[model samples]
Target: MQPEGQAKRLVIVSDAWHPQVNGVVRTLTKLREQMEARGFEVTIISPADYRSAPCPTYPEIRLALTHPLAIRARIEALQPAYVHIATEGPLGIMARRACLKNNWRFTTSFHTRFPEYLRERLPVPLSWSYSFLRRFHNAAEHCLVPTQSIHDELAERGFATLKVWTRGVDRELFRPQPDVDLKLPRPVFLCVGRVAPEKNLESFLSLDLPGTKLIVGDGPDLHELRRKYPNTVFAGKKEGETLARYYAGSDVFVFPSRTDTFGLVLLEAIACGLPVAGYPVPGPKDVVGASGAGVLSDNLQKAALGALEMGRVDPDVRLKGFSWEACADIFESVLTTIGSAKVLKSRKVKSDRVIPAP
Candidate 1:
């Protein structure tokens, strides 16, 4: 590790970048800020820097069409102290290859459940997808996950070298804005995130709960969901102060997703003094964690109603353990470990090779 004041370069390769406002993007953006604050120079290799094609069914997420040689050249030019692949997309694959061809050790992060996502849209077997992802991640020195539940789930599915890399909420930006006028009815049960099948929005929308059901954010399922649930208000995509206002304006933040590795929106809700209601699943299970911040139940209706009666918990205290600073600290430690592994491997190669006597 470098001295306290020393700055080291970190090159991050991710297929998911700007114009895509998801958890992975949010997490990476915050992570880069925190890392830079801690004396690290960060370089991002994203689709923005190369020619790209739109991902089918998800045109918002552009796929990099850059050549392998170009990727290697760019990475080599940066001469980063460490390389971290932030997604399992095209750019990540190229970066992995570059590192492997140069015999350089790199770290990777599993931000989404690709196997589950794929199975949702295709007739592909979960085992085949998991097997494919397993090979991609297994090549890395370490694979960072968001929660223990995810770490455990991935481990069960044959993922190795896993580490728990938790996420943090931007409390300053997501704090309670009780003064904002949502003009919705009392006990407004709001769900924020992409309105897609994987998010289980129908489970919440279909709930026969009293009060206005508000949906914040947009997705492919927006039009269909809007048509199906005419009573529920679809506010489309919201960000910055507007998003926080939506969070604070609501009584309960209903998270119906069963697939998210970590539902970052839950943290944002808490940060905005909104309680959560969701299934007792991985993402919500870890975040709520016995803190009276939210209610998790098998019955979505029961959970949503239960959350309305609960008072908002102090996010500052409830989420005292989570912060970008700490997240960055752990990330830095991981980079340091990878650097050490590189040094050890270099030594091993020298020690093992038979040199001719001169």
Candidate 2:
């Protein structure tokens, strides 16, 4: 530590990025832009790209999973002031443990409700998994959450030092153009995100209603799912203008994930003026309750049917109070605070490293 005023370097480690088509990747990418603009030197450490929903529009970032001892040596050579571990995977665990032993502070993000997601797919009860998750996150000095609801939920379950830095939607890309109608038949139902079993997408496909199902993403389950449900139009992964058009064209957006800590995609659907219809769970619960954004239910079929009866809501209602600019601004503040603290901490560490044991 060379005095409190020295500049600090920030490194972020996560298992999700680039190829992963989810909220954390989007948030971290935007946050990187914001942090760099604020004069912080940023480094990202992530695993090699893996299979995600494969959004065609956005280019993937360059990443490496675990570079041997040589890669670790290279990272240490850079001398990062703080390592911010954002996921609980092999790479992230290594980063966190290394930082902890060396007296360096690290922060983490709670994005996915992994316990619930894994439980829905596997055999373990959520309670046992939650305790395991709590242990993993408790290692961090500060763990970030995207909503007050998630924060409260985690806190109640014994997670500590929770913080909030919400996800943002790109308003420019997802602007509401009510003048341009999709011209689909009345009561069109749209479902975005992965077409996998975990997404609980089968319910949306079986919505026994009047309109066509506009399925706008792809996953491993796409082939069988498309074949099983001829009612759905498989539009694969789309982005930018294409995605906005898909959202704009639909009358209702159907999301079926209860395991999302914050459904950034839910906000994206709302941003395009498409009223949402999904289960009354975590992601939808937060977005809908906060913005009165869309119709929701415990049953997807019920929600879809209820949406048809909902008629039309003012588009401006759901579109209000959301923007990517605002999300980036909040992220800037968090990085600034962390950067300042890291500088002071580095100085103390340096001072201690120099002094001999008394």
Best by lDDT, which number?
A: 1
Q: What Cα-based lDDT does every candidate model obtain? A: 0.85, 0.70
Model 2, which residues run further than 4 Å from truth?
Answer: 1-8, 49-74, 179-183, 308-321, 329-358
How many clashing pairs in candidate 2?
5
Q: Each prediction's TM-score against the native?
A: 0.92, 0.83
lDDT of 2: 0.70
Candidate 2 residue 329 Cα shift, in angstroms, is 4.6
Cα lDDT tens digits, model 2, 238-326, are: 87798888887777888877667777778887777777787877778777767776778887778877766764455457646556666
Please report the candidate that would top TM-score against the real structure.
1
Q: Please list all clashing residue pairs in model 1, or write none if there are none.
A: none
Please provide the root mean square deviation of candidate 2 (C-alpha atoms, Å): 5.3
| Count of backbone collisions in candidate 1 | 0
Candidate 1: lDDT of 91?
A: 91
- Per-residue accuracy of model 1 over 182-219 as CA lDDT, tens digit each: 88777799999997778989998889987799999988
TM-score (C-alpha) between model 2 and the true structure: 0.83
lDDT (0-100) at residue 110 of candidate 2?
Answer: 86
